[model samples]
Target: MADITGIPPQSIDPDQALWPNAGTIRSSNQTNAAGQAGNAEKPTANNKDGIYVKDRLEDKDVKPEKIIFSNKLEASTYLKLQQLATYGGENIQEILEAALTAYFVGKEEASRPLPPKVLAVLRKKYPFL
Candidate 1:
């Protein structure tokens, strides 16, 4: 015959009788009281002197500045120019202007098409052209 409690036979020990007050059990009311106490100890509002508050203010102050340059190579060239200027005792602004001018001149030269001979070879290889 099966036990009316619906518990498995192996789980129940016939040698030891079950007591009503044996193991530790917590009620729902006790858990709610503990949760309320923990919540009360937690901070309700943000602290003005906190790291997050300082970072927010710093972020607002950081504005992107306008940078006028022809290309990435021009910027890189400008850095090299600055280094040369340091060694030659010239000003950074002067070096930057010279680099900018050289970049523009080189760009203009590169924009022009190849000569007729080079164009003929390219055309032979690429039918679409």
Candidate 2:
């Protein structure tokens, strides 16, 4: 998956061209247009630059499986959330999940106390319902 470009085919030695059209290997004294000695580093599997296709593919595989979750919050609320995260030694996402879960649970418990018909009957029995 390595690719090298900008080399003329005829200049490559037959034995050194391990495969057809492999990149040129310059003699020690040869200089590129920049006048730098032709000591260009060869791309390798462990190179961090990802100049080769395989290196880029491997990088993709090694990346963390996380997605960006963006939202806007009031300044005060955002500050409170950040403080809670710092004090509790947990992340904002965890705190938000717990808070939302508790809120829904409270709503469910409130609903469990009475059906609408029963509440209406109670309201009729006591005007101050």
Candidate 3:
């Protein structure tokens, strides 16, 4: 499988136009009247000269949480649920609950802890003692 970078290029017909206007194609190096490229990169919220929040690190609203997965199957299922949530206009929590319900309905063993090595590492890093 190809490395995860961005969207992979799909095979399309060369004769058919990709966009709405077939003839007119916008160039990235398009210049204005002053002979300078009008396509200037705007600073994002994370950038130094950004117009948005000056210090995102100091922001109280950015409450980041970590979600630990047991296996690749669970991780893949969670990713699918996330996509489903986005497409179906449902919240992630709702999607996750629905997925978990479906998953547990047929399964006998519901609760399973992380592997010994993983648990040990996690315990060492984030000790309860």
Number of backbone collisions per candidate, in order?
A: 0, 0, 0
Q: Against the true structure, candidate 2 has what lDDT? A: 0.52
lDDT of 2 by residue, 35-110 (tens): 4223334556556554664334443322234332468999999888765654554555557768867888847675
Off by over 4 Å in 3: 1-88, 113-115, 124-129
**How well is each residue in 13-96 modelled by candidate 1, as lDDT tens digits?**
543344322221222355553444323232333475644432343423223341223445577776776556544545444556
Q: Clash pairs of candidate 3?
A: none
Error of 1 at 17 (Å): 91
Decoy 2 TM-score against native:
0.29
User: lDDT by residue for model 3 over 20-121, one digit each (tens)?
Assistant: 222221232334312422333343575665634523345222223433234445778777765554456455544555767898985656656678998899
Winning candidate number (lDDT): 2
RMSD, every candidate, angstroms: 29.1, 24.1, 16.2
> Compared to the true structure, candidate 3 yields what TM-score?
0.28
- Go through the candidates in order and give each one's C-alpha lDDT: 0.48, 0.52, 0.49
- C-alpha TM-scores of all predictions: 0.21, 0.29, 0.28
Q: What is the Cα root-mean-square deviation between model 1 and the actual structure?
A: 29.1
Model 2: weakest 10-residue lDDT segment is 21-30
Which candidate would rank higher by TM-score, 1 or 2?
2
